[model samples]
Target: MRTTFDFSPLFRSSIGFDRMLNALETASRIETVDNWPPYDIAKTSEDDYRISMAVAGFAQDELDITQEQNMLMVSGQKAGEDKGEYLHRGIAGRAFQRRFELADHVKVVGASLVNGLLTIDLKREIPEEMKPRRIEIAADKAMPKGATKKIEGEKHAA
Candidate 1:
């Protein structure tokens, strides 16, 4: 099946280059791979996010995490150990690679391995100018005759 995205409106709007690049990067990465060593993305707060990946049989030293060009790459490689005898082996101790696309202003806070799961935290700090702000309008302004205020399709005439 083929999917289509209509981003014409966004391109015509005031979206910046960084945002456009980030969006395109995300779309491109989505077509690159499927779920492997399955993971979860959770939003802890308005500015914090957590990504947890199942990495059983892989030690903390065998994993690598890096952030490059707004992308987070996590990889794991397990070393073969000498064994006297083994009847059957079912656990996965092979190599795996995972990539995550991060938006602009997103930063990796830290990473930790617990109970065979690697958790990476990220935080996005929106600048003061980028945050949403409410503008307080003065109620003392005298409206001229036939003046009207339109808000969300509601028109109030004075």
Candidate 2:
């Protein structure tokens, strides 16, 4: 079954969200999803994340990881080799490409491949200027010099 939604209405009013809307449109139109090379996503800390993928038989040289803007792409291609004899081929040794959409300020910190597992680490680092700040209100300086002065012709009631 396939489901599609028209997002042209949103594009008419929204600004600077072309990538996000396009991603949604693309996702909705994908009829057959390829879930090859199982993967896992985990939040290790408040601002840290980890993405681990099972990529057996693929060496580190054969894998490519790239981060562009808010998108993370991980692809793997097995080096060419001869398959002399094989009675049963169960383990997947195929090429695959995976993508992940990340929030703003999220960045790839590190990556490692160990025991047929490819792990990618990410951290969200908010800029100092963009972080929440506390503003100090002036108690006296805010008042005008003559704000509290009584009128020259006015008589004091007290």
User: All predictions: root-mean-square deviation over Cα?
Assistant: 10.2, 6.0
Q: Candidate 1: misplaced stretches above 4 Å?
A: 3-33, 81-86, 132-158
Clashes of each: 0, 0
Q: Write the per-residue lDDT of candidate 1 for residues 40-100, one digit (tens) a residue.
A: 9999999899999999888899999999977899999877764757788777677898888
lDDT of 2 by residue, 1-158 (tens): 55579999999999999988998998888777799889999999999999999998899999999999999999998889656698888888888999899999999999999999999999999999999999998776566766785567867898
What TM-scores do the predictions have? Answer: 0.65, 0.84
Ten contiguous residues with the weakest lDDT in model 1: 13-22
Cα displacement (Å) at residue 31, model 2: 2.1
The C-alpha lDDT values of all candidates are 0.84, 0.92
Stretches of model 2 off by over 4 angstroms after superposition: 141-147, 150-158
